[model samples]
Target: METFADLVRALDTNTKTNAKVAALADYFRSASDSDKVWTIAILSHRRPPRPVNTRLLRQWAAELAGIQPWLFEESYHIVGDLAETIALIVPPDPQNETPLGTLSDYLNAFADLKQQSEAQKKAYVFKHWPGMTYYQRFVFTKLFTGGFRIGISQKLMTRALSQATGIDEEILAYRLMGTWDPTSVSFKALVLEPQLEEQYSKPYPFYLAYPLEEAPEKLGPPSQWVMEHKWDGIRAQLIFRKKTLFIWSRGEELVTEQYPEFQVLADVLPEGTVLDGELLPFPGGRVGSFKDLQKRLGRKKVSRRLLDETPVILRAYDVLEWEGADLRNKPFHYRNQILNTLLEQLHDSGQRYPLDGSPALEIANWESAALERERSREKHSEGLMLKRKDAPYRVGRKKGDWWKWKVDPFTIDAVLTYAMRGHGRRTNLFTDYTFALWDENKSGERELVTFAKAYSGLTDAELRQIDAWIKKNTLERFGPVRSVTPHHVFEIAFEGIAFSKRHKSGVATRFPRILRWRKDKSPEEANSLSDLKLLIP
Candidate 1:
């Protein structure tokens, strides 16, 4: 626990990526094998189920610290993080202190927590708190809650592992796929001695594109690039291996059951064919709106009526595997040809298979490409994607080959009506804010109706300025949220808009971000609810 605490401190304090990778690599090289497995599990969001609820932990911590429950509550609001607050308030007991147990020992001990009485659980928790340092306790409590979000990406994790084990990062990434399980298999077999059968269901890391920095024509002649519409749908990989159809989301989830309609692919596609594509809820040939597709998501099982109403199709963009050969190393034009042939097969099938080819954007120059991007809204696509015809598919977000040229987001000026303190270093500052649009009440007075909430796209300096404004203009306090004077106008931008019954304004916006602080405008000058309604299409 002490060593792990040091690792966390090093990781948390360092701002440089190299320093973080070094700290993680050092810990991976030196930590116990069992501890290493647990660390990997926790960092990768694979923690065990929470053994105890938070209310009891707070009560017990307050008693151990000899502080009143209200005092703990006050500190909790100010600190805004339970683990940090308890770690700060808990008193040290040097005389009664003992060496902290290993992480494996703690996890094994927690297995018996459900069987223990409330008093037994309290005693068991209190037994371990006193012996550990504050940071160690913070980590332990956070693990118990199972909400561990550190800054490490899978790419960085693989890089650190590569440094520690003398393995290439790319191979490590493939081994750490959708179906890789650390609990059931040893780390050695998972990374160093991987079995091909075990990895058959796993998805290769997706190759992402950077947003195009300059105009598309800056790259080269139009003949050198292959362009396609960037569909606003789930980025997924469809696998037909071992006579099974597995659809894996980009997040590494095996969501095969979500769209059982995909099962029909096993009838037409040959074994060992893997195609990368966007999953669109398009029946026949016409594509549905994003909202129509979202209804099919978040369901344990799709109803017959819902499935028929919003049938889905895969717009195949690239072919990763064909027959049995791994053609990822082939050029883009070659893989695209392979994808075309598969789509031809799907078309020949008498039954309407849910698969189609994303047509290439035909452009003579960069200026023409810009005009095509503006037409994305007409087709319900987000933007255009440009890929070099000669580049091989690569892992993760490598910057050279592919680029996304997205349309400018739809924007609206709205009034900031409510504010709240955010967690972490910004806990004392009101960074999270709810925005509202102007609506006319029956009384003939302009009213504010909440429509969207945003907390990002502002610099620290800008946040501090708004935080000061919110503190000075607070009209009422409803717990942590403050109803502030609605004077400040912010230009909110979003990818798309949809009519939603859940929202009070009868609408919802996708990927809302503060485009700019419209300091020049007044609350009355903000956009109207009716104006937002027109954007629902």
Candidate 2:
């Protein structure tokens, strides 16, 4: 326990990746099996379930801190984060309690317990929580129950692991995707497994995300690029391990049951292989809109009709594993060769897994003259992605290896038709807006398509001015939204547009923002349904 406390002290002192990883690795290497299991449970239990009511939460907070509920509530507003606020007000007893440690230790410890029994684990955890306060318990609950999110990210964790183990970050990341029991098996056992052969060929494309600061021009000519439509879909890593299909989203949620269509791919694609690609809905032989995908996203079960209507397809861009070979360390060009070969083999096998070789489906090598000519014509494609053939797979945004060249946005003059009160900082202001496009066929009839609901992109003066207008010009009042007359014409800009049946205008916009206010344009001159249609893919 004292050793664990010392480890926490080391971790909290410097939040550097290397330090965190080393502290975690050392703790795991030294701690007993019982201590390692309990530590995992403690870390996993950091978040408690949200109370049914604020009154209950307030009471809990007050009791935990030995303060009145009213006083706690008053202080909560100033502190923002409730857990941190309570921790500050009622500091934990240093004599008996254990402080929070590095993330690497928690992760490694949890990884170790992958083979432990539930009853034994629960008993181990309960035996360790004596003399802890309710606030400490709250923190413990958060850590153990998988809600302990903080400033740390998985990328940072991977970086720390790389530094500690002297392994390549990319290799570590790929291995982390696999299931391993740290308690039963050593880290070396997890990494040194022989690569298995791929049974059926499948397209597993890797993506190259750009950094926030680097622009497209810095990467050189567009012809040297392999341009593909960057679809706004779920980033999925498809795995066919031990005869079962496992589809892991970017959020690390297991979504195999949600997308049953890919089960066929699981049966056909080679076993013991992992593929990374986008999971998108294709309805009526077309790529379904983002709005369409949103309908299926939240659903836990899919009806036969819904599944038939909105089928999903994996837009394979890169191959991570093939025939049990870890191709992630291989350069993009070499991996691409393996990917193309697999696609051809799958097509030749007459497989119905949507792994056919098609020009539109594959994004490799762009023509300079053709790209510029077709730039305006490609509606769904947000931009061109350029990747160096020999670049390794990196976790976060990396420069030089990849670049995204998006086309200029399509703007539309839309009228502000509705407003709603914003949350948090803009709680008092009517910042949420619903803009409308002109319905040319009907007189004074404008279809409200959610053009932009911006609580941002407005100056303080502009916000105040708009707030005043929203209060005055509100025609009718709903619970949270206020109907307004179509008087203000604002130029709305968006990166991509898609045809959506759910929306009023049968369309949805991505990343819409206020480019400028076109006060001079009348409601009659505002962009119409046809104009938005041209922007759809």
Largest lDDT belongs to which candidate?
Answer: 1
Model 1: ten consecutive residues of lowest lDDT:
176-185
Tell me the whole-model lDDT of each prediction, alpha carbons only: 0.83, 0.61
Output the number of the TM-score-best candidate: 1
Q: What is the lDDT of residue 133 in candidate 1?
A: 83
- How do the residues 168-220 of candidate 2 rate in per-residue lDDT, one tens digit apiece? 65554455543334444544445434224222222233355773245444556
Q: Give lDDT tens digits, candidate 1, residues 1-537.
A: 777778888988899999999999999899877777777777766765577888898898899999999889778878998888888888767875666877766666676686789988888878777766889888777767667666787668779989999987756766665444444656776667855644576667799999997867678788888789999888999998888888888876567888898898898887788899898988556887788789877576898987888998888899998887888999999999888887887677666788888976556788888888888888889999999888898999999899999999999999999998899888998999899998989998989999999999899999999999888999998767899998999999999998888999999899898989988998889999999998766
RMSD of each: 3.6, 8.8
Q: How accurate is candidate 2 locally (lDDT)?
A: 0.61
Q: In model 1, which residue pairs have backbone atoms overlapping below 3 Å?
A: none
Q: Which ten residues in a row have the lowest lDDT in candidate 2?
A: 194-203
lDDT, candidate 2, at 214: 51
